[model samples]
Target: MFSNAVKCRQIHLIATSIAHYWPLLHERPLSTLTTTAISQEPSMFVTSSIFIILYCGLSLMLCWCDYQSGLLPDRFTCPLLWVGLLYHLYLSESTLSSAVWGAIAGYVSFATIYWLYRGLRGYEGIGYGDVKFLAALGAWHGWSVLPQLVLIATILACVTLGIKIIAGRKRQVLYNPLPFGPFLAAAGLWCGWQTLISPPP
Candidate 1:
């Protein structure tokens, strides 16, 4: 955990204390509270939705911080990932080995593509941020859908490039680093859902 995260957590604690003591504080609960007002239990979908929203918001902030500070801070990213992986491991206890291998496979697939680009261009093609994101995705969803992620990312990039070309915004076929992480993550989720709903041979 990063130092800033520690400070942020402390601030949150103080705010919670203030909110708790202040009877005037009245934040509406979005879902039915369990047995107590302080149960801290929302509907599962609501909780998942909030988590996803927070992840995207944090990812945007992290991306901006990376652009500004030239470094990826672990404050938000690491804890969320660690907890997510544990959640995943617990949910798929019988397939823990598959998840571990899937993570490795996802990393290898993406890293291999990354290296291939580097070799052909003789320059740094992908950044460590992308590498880490892919690794995290691997850990989250495993490797079975990694190929779909790559395919979808490529199609999205091509479509983006096509639009740029059609609009006459640029001249060269420059392979700019777009936010491929989101597409990969989204595609993996879609494919994973499909697989879960329709198991195959």
Candidate 2:
């Protein structure tokens, strides 16, 4: 079980790497980073589509890897994210650097939770892997996905916690070190879809 920071970090790295690889495998238009090969102009829908593809694919892979190996092998997510940064820079043709900020925001937010878990003695409450995984996820869509991600994570964590409490009927159940990466990844996917459908500011 992923009962430690190292395990959490490993999961994060794996999930991030999966997210980074998605665009490469998808054959996205190098120039537009959109859904179709059209004029150079960008459309939010196209961006959202690409993001969804990456998010979903990455989510499944990360979860599966966690289940089977119990190790999210760093050889994957970390370096792959750097590659994703370069890839996004080349494709989107924008100086805003969406990927870089997204990754940074994800790491900061997730890391904050990780530290909080440590401070509060809430191990098994969250993992370091959850943190890095968010880095890659945030790198995908940035802060826009964060609110929804938190909402989803909170909802799922509560539901699971309740179920866990019920399953054993123990007053002081030691929470198992389970994977939160997949849930957060799902939240990110749903959040990306929301961005696609919502009216722009």
Candidate 3:
């Protein structure tokens, strides 16, 4: 329910914070930096830690909001997508073209499935928010990681559904709408973290 102006302000703050702190996060040799270095340069270490904490915190907020409200506001998803693109652009870890294509492919793939499902079933089977969330993830990780990301998310969601049905002890549980955002967020976080530690070639 945030106003557009408020959302813009928030995104600006986040972008500025990242621009200020991100270089410190990568300033050290991640593979070689040790406890001695961390103790010597606590400010740099703490700033880098804060950046990741904020990143994960924002993602968790999105997951919680989606689960509770069944809505993924453009405020959160748009910033996520744009920040990811900017991250790669600033770091040059991946081509801008790759990130752009990843975003497009992610959005289009899910959007197509969403429409097809609605067309055949006469009702929405997938939320538009999920499409946006996936696109944000793609912007962070690129298209190559999407298949595995989706597969992991699907399995987690299915397992959760199965557990729900069993706990309820009812076959009718299949009709209930389950939120998929949490699973997607979990998978996205894992994939993103992996890429951060060991970037793709």
Candidate 4:
């Protein structure tokens, strides 16, 4: 009876050892699993840094072009619109339909104001290029951001124009056409930067 009991205890010990090491024999090492998991996710810091550099650089270039030439070329705005749409397509942060509607709303809103101002005042108040630029920005930021964009741009434009008049010391009212693209680009950049820096809830 004692001999049988000893044999049973020995068998139990062996079975316990096998169970503990079963994964070692059948599965990959823990280090490999860790490496694979790390590789799957992107670092938000790196992605945000790259986005800021590229987007802000592009904004500055557009600002310079508009300030100097009073034009936001199709070369810039068209690519901007396509890239925004593609970003939404791949990232899935926003729906493609939202972007399309945003673009249409941006263009139509500005065009309506432009035509109404022309009819009432007998001159163009804003350029067609500004309309396209706003549409591109809308595509990038979606329709929800358009109202804020316009409000910020308008406020800044008014403030800047006031400062310029004060600086020039012109007592009489001077109705000079100012390039609106820079204000729009600046407001767009501010919105983008805010979005990037804020943490997701």
Count of residue pairs whose backbone atoms collide, per candidate: 1, 6, 0, 0
Q: In candidate 3, how many Å is residue 192 off? A: 1.9
| lDDT, residue 99, model 3 | 78
Please name the candidate that would achieve the greatest TM-score relative to the true structure: 4
lDDT per residue as tens, model 2, 65-117: 76565445454456435544644554453622666787888889878877887
Position 152, candidate 2: lDDT? 90
Candidate 1: which pairs clash? 102-143
How would you encode candidate 3's per-residue C-alpha lDDT over 1-201 as one tens digit per residue? 469989999999999999999887887566356866667567644544554555576578889988898788888888888877775675555466777788888899999999999999999888999999889878877888889999999999889878877798456555657788888889988887776443334
Question: Which candidate has the highest lDDT of all?
Answer: 3
lDDT of 1 by residue, 1-201 (tens): 699999999999999999887654443333334345446334434554554555456556555665465444567446535544654554446555555676677667667878898999987566555666666555555566667767876787678778888988665545444555555545555554654332221
Candidate 4 worst ten-residue window by lDDT? 192-201
Tens digit of lDDT per residue, candidate 4, span 9-114?
9999999999999988767677688887687445644554554565566667778999998888888888777776665665555466777787889999999998
Clashes of 4: 0
Model 2, stretches more than 4 Å misplaced?
1-55, 68-71, 79-87, 94-96, 119-125, 169-175, 195-201
Name the runs in model 3 displaced over 4 angstroms.
Answer: 1-51, 169-175, 198-201
TM-score to native of every candidate shown: 0.57, 0.59, 0.71, 0.75
TM-score for predicted model 3 compared with the true structure: 0.71
Error of 1 at 168 (Å): 0.9
